[model samples]
Target: MYVAVKGGERAIENAHAWLAEERRGDRAVPELSLAQIREQMTLAVNRVMAEGSLYDPDLAALAIKQARGDLIEAIFLIRAYRTTLPRFGATAPVDTGGMACDRRISATFKDLPGGQVLGPTFDYTHRLLDFALAAEGEPPLAPAGGDGDMAPKPHVMGFLDREGLIEDAPHDDSPPPDLTREPLELPAARALRLQALTRADEGFTLGMAYSTQRGYGRNHAFVAELRIGTVPVEVEIPELGFAVEIGEVVLTECETVNQFTGSKTEPPQFTRGYGLVFGQTERKAISMALVDRALRWEELGEDDSGAPAQDAEFVLPHGDNVQATGFLEHIKLPHYVDFQAELELVRRLRAEASAAQSDTRQEAAE
Candidate 1:
């Protein structure tokens, strides 16, 4: 005698109330402020902003706090919030060439024009947790030099381009297909794929990229250059009749040089894989580049190794953590009716088989 439960709305409300209480644990302790999270938890805020495809640090920080530090949930909140906002005119693509680079390194060349400004990075730092950071004290600050301006660095890939060694990525005026507005169709263009990658879940993209390095779809990639810096964003004003800089966003850009030995149709040339992410997310940026290269199997005249990273159909849909989490967690919801139907069918089938077996035995005895 089972009865269907009601009051789902009240249950959800009560659960949320309890959750809020738990999130703000220990009432004696001071509650964490959004500003503190934004400043101290900069990396987490950056992640939310990167995956959410929105640039507001304050909003991302608030979302992180409300999500109880669950970065995926925070990204989801930001995405949901972003959908409600009205879209104005599109901004012109920011030029990475004139970026005010804080950290820039080149793996291909020994020295470059910019002289490899390692502004702020954990690359050389020992991973040991510093106990000193736990206690607030005035730490010795590193001396800052350079006239507050880094010389405009020429792209390393540009040198290769000068020699006509790399494949040409010609500029085109054709508008890219919008993934949000249109339903996802198979065989997405490079532009659409890039859009998907920039906002794709970092963990998923990292795993896919790792799979490639492990011989799934090895591209023999070399990091041509990796840069982290701030770039100005400008939007055109039809009324004012001029473009103005709205703000600047910190970005991490990665470019990988992949060699293609030779193809039947095309001659041997260096191919490039590019990644540009909305924060100082180097790992995601690098991973994106590798995955991007692997996905270009068809266009580059290379045989598909049947790798998950190379499969656009497999990668694009699952790259979104929000959709993945929703689909994965939906199993927890009530499915009693469906399960009861299945259970009854199974029981009936088992009973019929037992009856048939009993009849067969009786007939044999007779």
Candidate 2:
């Protein structure tokens, strides 16, 4: 239990003032503009948007600036701010199949339709820090690529679907349960699980996904496809009675095809795990896909050998960094009353033991 200390108002105000001062360090240095953060710190902004469940880059950048670049703190700030905003009707499900892909690849296929577009990626770059970046100078422009076909890229999984080699993921038109609006319930549906995993702590999800790769609830996953691009977001207008494109959002999507041997009830078709997240967060998307697959052990007719990723209760509750940080940090608050009670109990127990020993000694002397 934490009691409010009435006398600390002035001290708290002073501390807050000092914190504001600390947040704006070295007055001679020019302040970082929101535009700079939006452009340069794109990945961080993307992470905040994904985890905070908000898509405004400007707001995410502001949160980052206010939090002094502490990502979890920024996410916390963004989440708190999100609670104040008015909610509009939900947007229709984004059509990723029509994505204007910037980067698209498949580990399962050597060469596919629409071919490979490398785009701007750091995959092949040397890890060494360039001192040139420290000295500000405009870099040379990138060479233009060939004017390729403008047709929408077909999903790699579609080929396997035609051959009846992969399990069919029938489209569901029903409204999905909103985790934000309602409390998370156990035995969560796949849609809810995907929602949680998309915004889950990337490191924790990655670790859980890695554990599966190491043979704990192992499902031999092949990255059937990974794509990064912008897709049009459409929402049905009440007046118009038809969906219209509102805007575009960058998203990274992953589809993992896991080996599923034929069961008595089902066929030997390849099972699929899917992940989709805001912006170009491929690692999180991939990890989410792996963990998503692991959690489907019961549905896939595989035995649950007790893997952390497979436990929905364990994964979903702890995946949120904001909630995790809040719970973990709350202990640092004033807990003197609770501690005093614990101390008193320990003292009483020790005194009783000491008295018992003394009585035993007196009995011996008699």
Candidate 3:
């Protein structure tokens, strides 16, 4: 016998109320201010912005707080909020060549024009927990400086390009297809693929990239240059007749030089995979570059290695954690009708088998 349940709406409301109280925890502890999260949990804010495809720190912080530090949930909140906002106009492609670099390094060359700078990286840090941070006193501030003599740094790729040692990625003026607006189709363009990779789930992208490194696709790559800095954003005002600087956004960019094989028509030249992401996320940017190159095998005229990272069809759809999680978690929802049908079928099969076994046994005994 099946008894139909009711009051889903009321139950959901009560559950949400309980969840809200639980998120706050004990009333004795003071509620965390939004500014505290924005400043203290800077990396978390950056991840939310990068994944959510939004750059607002304050809003990202709020989402982080509201989501109770679940980064994917926070990203979901930020993305949902972003959909409601109206777009003004498109900004001109940011000139990363002229970025005011705070952290810049090159692995291909020992020294470069602007010189390698190691700024605020944990690469050298001992993993020991500094109990000092647990108490949290005002730490001494580092000296600030202006962008004096910040001439345009020549790209590491420029050196290879000048010598004709690398494949050329020519400038294209064709407008890219908007993935957010249109339904994702098979065999996406390079621009659309890049857009997906930029905001793709970090863990999924990282694993796929790692698979390539561990001999799946096996494109031996060197980090040509990695940079984290602020770049000016410019937007064209139709009335003004020209683009003007609107603001600046902090970004991390990675360029990887992958060894390539020459065909009869083309000479063997090093190829590049590029990644540019919001905030100072180096690992995600690097992983994104590796995956980007793997997906470009067809365009680069490389043999189809059939790696998961190399397959655009596999990589793009599973890259969004929100979509993947929703589909996976939805299994827990009410499936009474479906399960009941299966139950009946299972019971019928067992009864038929038991009757057949009894008939066989009786025949054998006789």
Candidate 4:
């Protein structure tokens, strides 16, 4: 017997209420303030901002708290909120060259014009947990003469270009294609696809990069530069007919030097892998570069090894962990219809085989 039950409106209301309750937990526990999450759980805020493509720490912190620390869900929240935001206008690309760099390092040259600054990193820290933090003690005071805010922006590539060591990169005010709006097509331009790649799921991107390193389609690479810091964002005002500074955002940028094989027509040119994102995420930027280089094998005249990283179809399709994980988990739902069909086929095949064997024995005896 089949009976239909439907409570669409009631069900949705109940779900929302339940989600609210889960987010708040029991009233006895102190409610987590948005500022607390923004300041204290900064790494979570970084992930949410990185994946969400939003730079507001407070909003990201709120999303993290509401999502109960589920970073992806928080990202989804931020993304949803971002959609509702009215676009006042497009911003002029920040002058990375003018950026008052807080942290910058160049791997290509040991000693560059602007001396390397290792601003803040956990690289040298011991792995021991700080029990003092657990007990809640005041953190060390900031050094005197410090406003943590960085100044303008500057690109490390400026020094190289002055000497004409590398090809000059062109800048344009032309609007770039939006992947979110249009259906993705094959042979995607580097700009369009790269934007999508940056906001892609971290784990999926990591796996694709790992495959290249594991010899799937190896591209020898060296990190030429990796930088993390705040850069002022500016927008062009049509009415004002000039650009105005709006805000600053933390960003991570990576440029990888990849060994390339030149074709008969073209001379050997040093190839590049580039990644830029909104947050101090060296790992994501590094992984993004590796994957970016692998995807450029055809353009670079390198033979394709048919690796997932090299195949735009495979990488772009399966690169989103949210989509992949959802389709994967959805299989746990009721599959009895398909199972029943398979069961019938198996039984029919077995009966036919037995009859065929019986006929063969009878014929032999006769």
Candidate 5:
């Protein structure tokens, strides 16, 4: 029973004003520019874009700035703003196999086609923090690369396919279900599950993926390929009767080859788990792939170990940080009426028990 309480308009206004003041922080420090957040805090912006399901870096940076570095808050803002935009036509599926890769590597094979190109990465960096970064100074530039042939690299999984070692990827020309437009239905298709996982909270997804690695729903996975690069997006224009190249967007794609035992009607072969996300978010991409494989227990004819990662019902609903945060924070709101009702019930039960005890004592004395 929620009773409307009035007369806090002034207080509410003042509270909002105070919040704005706090968000601004001390006037002595220079205000952060959107460009700084976009360039310097690139990872943070990428996270906002990935989780918020919006591709615009500028808008993500603005949301981060407005939310005062609170990423969940930024995601909420982006999602809210996303609902207001007019619908544009959907683009063709990106050809990741033809990506102009900046970073590409394979864990399963020592040497593959399109020899490894280690772009900007933190894999070998020491954990030590550089104190010099605190001071504002221009860093030295990297040396120019030698002239080399620029061509699309072949997917590493192609090699495994030649030997019939891995299961073939299923091709579907039908349009996939849109979670943004439709409410989630249980027993979702792989495409829908992938959609939800892509926008899921990174921490939750990471933990779920880690659980699989730790023998919860163990799928012996090898990184067949992990590529980060820019891919062209094209949309078919009805008026022009042809597709035109729009722009390129950076994406990270991971394909994991997992061990699979042959089922009754199938030969033993490695299975695949795929993950693709906006921007250079390799961690999230890898996590998504692991969880993706775990959720494929039914399709792959694997035993249901009842792992949390394998349960779509359990994983999908709790994955969105925005939804989880909203439910949790709502408890901080006015629950006075509900609490009062519970209190009264408890008091009544105690009184009844006390009166019954007194009656029993009187009857015994008599």
Candidate 6:
């Protein structure tokens, strides 16, 4: 009896050791602390939390460092960790209407009930790189406002309702379906499918958005409103029998208005583009809105135009980096067995052809 090459287990163990050593490069560089990553590289932490669907900034930061700044890997780490966590309870959805907003603005209305506040945005900054950051100079602080009224959040939809410009946005109190718990099916409900897509990779989401812009299912969109801020998160403790504020989380919310192409029975109404994430990510929110609009082509009676965004099968299947990368990279594993089979078959076929050609030539000569 013949045996195949052994030491597969040993090889795997050594490779893991090498990887661990590589991950902790430059022992003198002072290891990155979770707090530093959480506070300084907050954007990276935010992305990890948003995509991983876990809001712990410190955890996300640690994942990022462990992943060597690979954001997608950090997200994967968070997702894996999230599965082992104990389920306590869920918080009621924060009334975005009651949000103690740090930043709020609307492009649709010149002035609304709640006045626009351009809180923290890089929008107005010049494109030139700052040389001061190289040396890490302390910058002067902007004048702080006193008695900043903690005003209740106001809705952009409310303003449209007052003007009779948009269809009344529905507020259903029923619990939405969980995308993570169930397998995805086509002709999906907006709530279920959108939740799945929100945690989707930024590059993938961006590609879908780009496809929509390139005439796949172009929907004219306006950023009706966008806001980013912190909100109190309350949880109901069963033993205490009372809801209590457990924590606060920062979130980015985006609402977009799109041209409402009406059907035979339905009247012309402005469609909505919605995106909500765990941090102040304007680009992600805006991109999400555009993609959301493109995905609504069927409901809007817009022609498919064979765009990537309009094709649910294509978009949904390829939207996740974790799944896509795993499946794609899995091809590298021990395919030598398959390769050997193909190689033998090709050689056998060639030998058979050569023999047949020689026999035919002899017969012709004779």
Report the Cα lDDT for candidate 3. Answer: 0.88
Tell me each candidate's TM-score: 0.94, 0.95, 0.95, 0.84, 0.95, 0.89
lDDT of 3 by residue, 1-366 (tens): 123235766688899999899889889989988999998888889989998999999999999999989999999999889989998889999988898888888999988999887777898899999898878787878667533225678789899999999999835689988776676677888888888988899999899989999988976789999988889999998998999998999999999999988886789999889899999889889999999889889877789977888999999989988788789989999899999999999999999999999999999999
What are the per-residue Cα lDDT tens digits for candidate 1 across 1-366? 123235766688899999999999999999999999998888888889999989999999999999999999999999999889888878988999888888888899878787787766788999999999879777887786732245688888998999989888735588987665575677888988988998899999999999998999977789999988888999999999988999999999999999898788767989989899987899999999999999999888888899999999999989989888889999999899999999999999999999999999999999
Per-candidate local distance difference test: 0.88, 0.89, 0.88, 0.76, 0.90, 0.79
Candidate achieving the largest lDDT: 5
Better structure of 2 and 4 per lDDT: 2
Which has the higher TM-score value, candidate number 1 or candidate number 4? 1
Each prediction's Cα RMSD? Answer: 2.3, 2.4, 2.3, 3.4, 2.5, 3.0
Off by over 4 Å in 5: 1-7, 146-150, 360-366
Q: What is the Cα-based lDDT of residue 194 in candidate 4?
A: 84
- Candidate 6 TM-score versus the reference: 0.89
lDDT of 5 by residue, 37-95 (tens): 99999889999999898899999999999899999999999988998999888998899
Any runs in candidate 3 off by more than 4 Å, and if so which? 1-6, 143-151
Clash pairs detected, candidate 5:
none
Clashes of each: 0, 0, 0, 11, 0, 0
lDDT of 6 by residue, 216-307 (tens): 67767888998888788888778999878877888888898887757786678787778888887777777788887778777667677887
After best superposition, candidate 6 residue 54: deviation in angstroms?
0.8
The candidate 2 region of ten consecutive residues with least summed lDDT is 142-151
